[model samples]
Target: MNEPLAERVRPKTLEDYISQHHLVGSKGSLTHQIKKGIIPSLILWGPPGTGKTTLANIIAEESKRPFYVLSAINSGVKDIREVIDKAKQSGGLFTSKNPILFIDEIHRFSKSQQDSLLGAVEKGWVTLIGATTENPSFEVIPALLSRCQVYILNAFDKSDLEALLKRAISKDKWLQSKKIVLKETEALLRLSGGDGRKLLNIFELVINSEASDAVIITDQLVLDKVQKNTVLYDKTGEQHYDIVSAFIKSIRGSDPNAAVYWLARMIEGGEDVKFIARRMLIAASEDIGLANPTALVIANSTFQSVSTIGYPEARIILSQCAIYLATSPKSNASYMAIGKAQQKVKETGDLSVPLPLRNALTKLMKDLGYGKDYQYAHDFTNNFVASEYLPEELSGTSFYVPGNNQRENALKTFLKNRWKEKYDF
Candidate 1:
C-alpha cells in the first residue's frame, strides 16, 4: 500500500488491536457493549497515538454499525451535520443499533460546534465516539460531556510497545520480505514515548533508510536515523514528555528562570494552554502542597483564565503561574502521606473498623457496641479528645512527615500538641 505503514497496519478487529485490555479484554466494560451491539456515546481520553481512532473503527465493525468519520481539526458544524444526515439516512434514529459518528480530536471543536451535536446525540441520531488527547472535562462542554461515558486510554506500557514491534515484523508482508533482527530497542521505545503509531513510523523510517534488505536494528542505528529527521518539539511524542518533565522539574527545583524558559518552549511550540496549566496545577499540589496552598489557587485560576482566553494571551497566564509555583515554598508532605497510607492499606487489607469509629444508626448496631464507647469530641474539653481513629492494629502509625517549611512546621507543632507524642510528628 502507498499509505504509511502505520495506516497500512491499522487494526481491523479488536483481536488485532493492542493495549487497553481493561476496556477490550474478556471482562472489559466495553466488551459486552460491543458484543451485544448496545454501543453508547463515549469519549475516549488519552495521550497521543493511543489508538483512539483505531478502537472507534473496531467498535463500529464489531458491532456491525455504519461508521462515519470527522476530523475536529478541520470539520465544522456543517461537516458534523453532513455526517449525521448520512448516518440518520443509513439507519433509523433511536433504534437499537445506531450509526457511529467518530470525531477525532473532539477537543478542538468550538462551543457552538459542540452544541450542534447535542440534539442528534440526545435524540440518538448517532452514537458519538469522541476522541481527545486533552481532558474531556476541561475541553468538552458540560452538557455534552454529561451525556457521554468517558473511557481513559493509558500510554502503552513497555510490553505493549514490544508486542507492537513483534506484531509488525511477524504480520506485515513488506517487513517479512526483509531479514530484520531487533538487536536492541531502547532508542526506538524511548523516542516513540509510548505512542504506538510513532514507534511504527520510526521503525519503518529506519528500515527504509537501510540500503540492504537485511536489517539488524540496534539502539545506535535507531537513534542515528531518528535524530536526522526528528523535530526539536514533538508535541505528542518523547519530546513532549521530556520538555514537560524539564518544565515541572525546574519548578520543583525552584528555578523560576528555567521554568519560564521551558514554559516558553512549550507555548512557542503550540502546546495546549490547558495542558501546560494542568501540569502546573499538579505541581502546585504534588510539589508545593502545605508549603504554599495558595499556589494551587493561583494555578487553578490560571487554568480557568487560559481556558477562557486562549493563545497569545494564555501564554502570559501560564508563565505567571509557572513563575509563582517555582518561587513558592516546596513540600511533598501531603503527597507522601497519602502514598504511605495507601501502601499501608495494601499491606493490611480490609482491617475491621474499631467499634467506636462505626456509626450507630440502628438499635441493633448500638447493641453490637457500635459507637457505644465513642466519646464526642465536641463534648470534651477544648473540643479535643485523645481517641484512636485508625484501626486498632495501627494505633500509632505515622504517615505524614512534615516538610521543613514554615507552614508545615506550624502544622507539625499542632499535630504534636494534639497527639502528645502518639505519632512521631
Candidate 2:
C-alpha cells in the first residue's frame, strides 16, 4: 500500500529535511546544540511547508526524550496543563531531561494558552518547540518568547525545490514504480511558489492523472490538470505570495496593466484591503522613491482611507493607489544608496563621527573641537554648503546616483552647480 503523500515525504531526521540550512545544516547552531543533547526552548518562525514540524519531530527523536504534541487550533489551557502534568510525571521535579512539547501554529495560541506553558518551560519541565508562520514578536507573548530562542526559517530556494522534486520521484516507492518523465518544470515551480507541500501535491496530481504506463510531466500537462480548478486568492495562504509576486514583478517591469491585474486578483481573493495598501506604501518608498515623490503621498493616503473604510468601497481607493504607483516614474536610487551605505558600514565596522557633526552638549566634547567649524547650509549660498559628513576613510565615497527622470535631472543640475567637482552625474 502506498503511504500518504505528506507522510511519505515527511523528513524523519534533520539530515533529511530540506531548506532552513541556517537552522538544521551540519554546522548550524541548532544542529550542534541538538547533537550535544542540550536543546533549549525555541520558536521556529517560518512560512508553511518549511519543515518546522518535521524539525521539531527530528529534535525529539534525536534527543531520545519524551515527546508531546499539541495544536494551537484545538489545544486549550486545560490541554496544556494536561501535557505539563504528563511531562512532570515523565521527568520528576529536579530531573534534567524533560519531555519536549511541540506546539504547531503556536502563533494562534491565545495569551492564556501560551502563558500556561511558560512556567513549565522556565522550570525545565519541558523543552518547548513552538512553530509559527507569523512573527513571534507579534504573536507569542513576551513572557513565552523570553523563554525561547527564535530561529527564522526562509522559503526554499529554486535549488532546494528541485532537490525535493528529485527526492520524491526517486525515494517514494509509489512514485518510483511509475514511469514518470519531467519534460518541463516551469509550471510546477510557478504553482508551488516555493512551498514544499504544494509542490509535492501538484506533482502527485500530475502523476496520478496519467493514463498510460509512461507518464511525462511537462508545463502543459501540469497546467492542463490544474487549470480547470480556479485558484482562489487566499489573502493569508499560498495565493497571497503568488499574487504579490506578480504585482511586484509587474511594477518592476513597468507594466501598469499587469500590475493592476494582480491588484484586482488580490482584491477578489479577499485579501485584507489594508494589507494590500501597506505593500503599495512600501513599494512607493522602495521602488518609486524620489523618481516621483508623490507616489509615497498617494500610497500613504490610500492606507489611511482603507483603514477608515473597508471592503467594496475601499477597493476603489486601493485600485487608484495601485494604478498611480504602477504608472509613476520608477527609480530605486535611494533604495540602492541606503543598501550600499549599510553594507559599507557592516564591512568597515564602526567609525568615529566627524568632529563637526558631533554633539557639543558636553564641555569636554566642545573643548575637543566637537561641532567646531560647522557651517550651516542656510548661511551658505543657494542653501548648500560643501562639507564632509562621512568618515576619513570614506571622505569621497559616492552612493546616491540620480535616475533619468525629470525630478532627478533637476536634482542633478542643482547639485552640479552647488558642489562643482564634488557632484557627478
Candidate 3:
C-alpha cells in the first residue's frame, strides 16, 4: 500500500517542520541544546498533529543519535525492555550520543509500564521523547515526569495550515502535476480543527475525487466531501464541546433524564471517562454549591474512581455522579463568590493585607503590630467575634452574599446573629 500523504510529507528535519518555532528557531531552547549535541529526555504535550513526532525525529537526526520508537497503545513493559536493550546496543559505549527513544501517545501508558522506563531513562541508556495529547501531569507517572522536561506544542494556526497545503502542492510529486486552487478554507480549517495531518488527508481526498486535472477547492466542496466522511462524534472535535456543554447544562437545569442521556452519549462515543467526571466535578461545585455540599465530594470520588477503573465500569460511576449532581439542589453562590472576589481584587489591585490578619512569624512582623490586636474568635462568645478582616480599602465590601436557600439561609441567620448586620444578612 502507498504511504499516506501525512507520512509522505512528514518533516524529516527542523528546517522542513512548520510551526513550533519557539522550540526549533534560532535562540530556541531545543535549537541551542541540539547545536551543543546535548538533548534531554522530554515529553511533548499538545493537541493532535502538532509535529511532536516530527520534532522528535528532527532532534534525533540533528543530534546524530540512534532513534527508536514505541507506541503506548500497543507497547507493554516487555516492549519497553526490548527497545531499551536495543538502545543499549546502539549506544555502544558512546555516552554523548545516547539513542533517542520516541514513544507516541505516551499518556496511554499505565503506571507499571511507565515505571519500567524509569531505570533506562535514569541511567541515560536512551534519551526518551514522549508525545501526548493529554496533560502529562495527570497521565504520566510522577517519577518519570520529574525525570523528563515537558515541552508544550500548540495547534497549527490558519497560516500554518495554509502553508502545509501550499507546500503539498508545490513539493509533492503527485500534487505538483495537477492545478489546484484554494478558493476558500473556512470549511477545511473548521473541519481539521488544527490537526495538520487530518487537513492534508482531507485535502488529498477532495483533490483525488475530482475527475479533471484542474481543481478548485471551495468551502462547499470541502463541506460536501467532509460531511459524508465525518464521524458522528469526535472526542477532539466540535461534537465533543457541544456534547459536554449539553451535559453540564442538563445537570444545571435539574434534568436528570437529560443529564443521563448526554452521559450515555459521551460513554458510547468513547469519551474519556476522566474528562466526563472532571466536568461533572466542576458542575457539582459551580451548580450545586452550598445547597448540596456533598455533591462536590461525590463528584471528586467519581473522578478518582473512574480514573482508576477506566472504561465500561467507569461509565457506571460517571452516570451515578451525573444523576446525583442533576438531582441535587442547585446554587451558584460559591462560584459567584469567587467571581466577585476576583473582580474586587482587579479593582483594588494589590491592596495591603490588614495588619491584624497578617502573620507574625518573624520579630519584624510582630513589631509592626501584625497579630497585635487580632481578635481571637475562638476565645470570644459563640466562638465568634466581629472583626475587620479585609484590607482597609475593602472594608464593608461583601463578596459572599449567601444565596436564598435552606442551607445558606441558616448561614445568613448565624452571620446576622454574630456580625450584627455587618454582612447585611
Candidate 4:
C-alpha cells in the first residue's frame, strides 16, 4: 500500500511498455538493433514520466546486459569512476553485451562528472544511456553527445494514458479487488499534465481515499483528492516547463502583470534562480533585441546577480529584470536575421568566400587573386565602401531586412545612406 502505484505497475518488459511504438515496435530501430544483439550508447531525451528510465531498464533487460544506475542529482565524479571501475571489471568487450550505464537526469551532472564517463563509454567498458528532460544540445557536452544516439520520447497521448489506466485496473491485484470504475478521466488527465507516473499516483491516491470497495472514479473525485494532497506545482516536471513558457510569453507579449505572476509562481515552486535568470537573458535578446539594447545588459547583470546572491534577495532582482523586459519595446530583427542567414547558408551549401573578402596570409593565395583588388573602407570617405562583400553567387542576396522599430529604422536609414543603390532599404 505504501509503494507508489507507478512503481508497482512499472512495465518490466517491452510487451508491457506503453507508447513510444516508434522505438519498440516490431520494425523499430531499437527493436532491429536489439534483435541483432547490439545496442548503441544512447541518450533518451524527453519530458518527465515519459518512460525514459523504464525504457533504459527494458533495454538492459532485453539485451541481457548488466545494468548500472546513477542519479546525476546525487552522483559525482568519484561515484562515476567507481561505477566505471565496476563496469570495467565485468569484462570490457562490446561482444559480451557490454554493461548498460543508465544515468537518470544526466543533464544535472557537472562537466567533470560527465567527463569521467568518456573513457568507459569510448572503450566499450559500458554502453552509456543518459536520460534528460532538457535539450541535449544545450545540456550535454558536444564530445559526449556526439558518441551517443539520441532518441526522443513523446509525452503519452490521451489514448496511451487511457490504456495505462485500463492496464492498471485490470492487472493490479489490489486495484482489481477495489473494483474501481472509471466514470470520467478528464480531470485525471488534465491534472497529470501528460505525466504517466503522476497520473497513476493520483489514481492510487484517489483509490486509497475511497472507503468503499466498489470505488467509482470521477472528475470531481480526482480533482478533490489531488487538490488536497498534491503540491501546487512540481517544479521538476511538466509544470516547470509550462510555467517557464508562460513567463517567457508574458514578457514577450509585453504583459508585465502576467510575467510577474508567473515569476512569483516559479519562485513559490522553488525553481532554480539561475534557470529563471537564464531564460530572461534569452528573452532580452530574442524578444527585446535592438529595440532596447539595455535590456540584454540588464538581463545579463541580473543573471550574474542572482547567481551570486541567490534566493529571497534574488527574487527581487529577477522581478525587476522581468518587468523591465516586459515593458521595453520589443523586436526580433537580430534573431530573425541569423535564422534567415542560416537558411540561406543551408540552401547555398558553403559558397566560396569572395576573393576580395578572403584573407591571403600566403604569397600564393595573393598571387591567385585572394585579397586582390579588395577595397579597404578606411581608405575611402566616411570609412565606407560599396563593394560586394557577399559570395559571388549571393552578391545581391539580403538576409537582414531591418525591423520596423525606431532603432532599426535609424539603422535602415544609415545603411541606405552609405550603400546608396546596393541596399534596398
Question: Which of the numbered candidates is closest to the native, going by highest TM-score?
Answer: 4
* Span of ten consecutive residues with least summed lDDT in model 2: 229-238
Better of 2 and 3 by lDDT: 3
Off by over 4 Å in 4: 94-96, 346-350, 361-368
Question: How much is the lDDT of residue 64 in candidate 3?
Answer: 90
Please give, for residues 1-425, the per-residue lDDT of candidate 4 as tens digits. 77788998899998999999899887676887865659989999988899999998888888899999999988889889888888888876754588999999998887888888888888899999999988898789998999999999999999999999999998888898887788999999988889999889889889988888988888988888888777766886668889999999999999999999999999999998878998999999999898889999999999999989999999999999999999998899889989989999899899998888889999999899999889999999999988998888887777777778888899899998987777577
Q: Alpha-carbon error at 249 in model 1, in Å?
A: 2.5
Looking at model 2, residue 37 earns an lDDT score of 69
What lDDT does candidate 4 reach at residue 252?
A: 97
3 versus 4: better lDDT goes to:
4
All models, RMSD in angstroms: 4.3, 4.7, 3.5, 2.5
lDDT of 2 by residue, 1-425 (tens): 46557568788877788877777787787988888768889999888777788889999898888989999999999999999999999873644477999999998788888888888988888999999987788679999998899999898888888888988888888888888888888888878877788788888877778877688888988999988754677564467877898898787677889988998898888886766887888899899999999999999999989988999999889878878888889889999999989999999999999999998998998999999998898997778788988888887677898888889999888877876786455
TM-score of each: 0.80, 0.75, 0.85, 0.91
What does the lDDT come to for candidate 4?
Answer: 0.90
- The candidate maximizing lDDT is 1
- C-alpha lDDT (0 to 100) for residue 178 of candidate 3: 90
Model 3, range 271-329, lDDT digits (tens) per residue?
99888988998998898899889999999999989989998888888888888999988
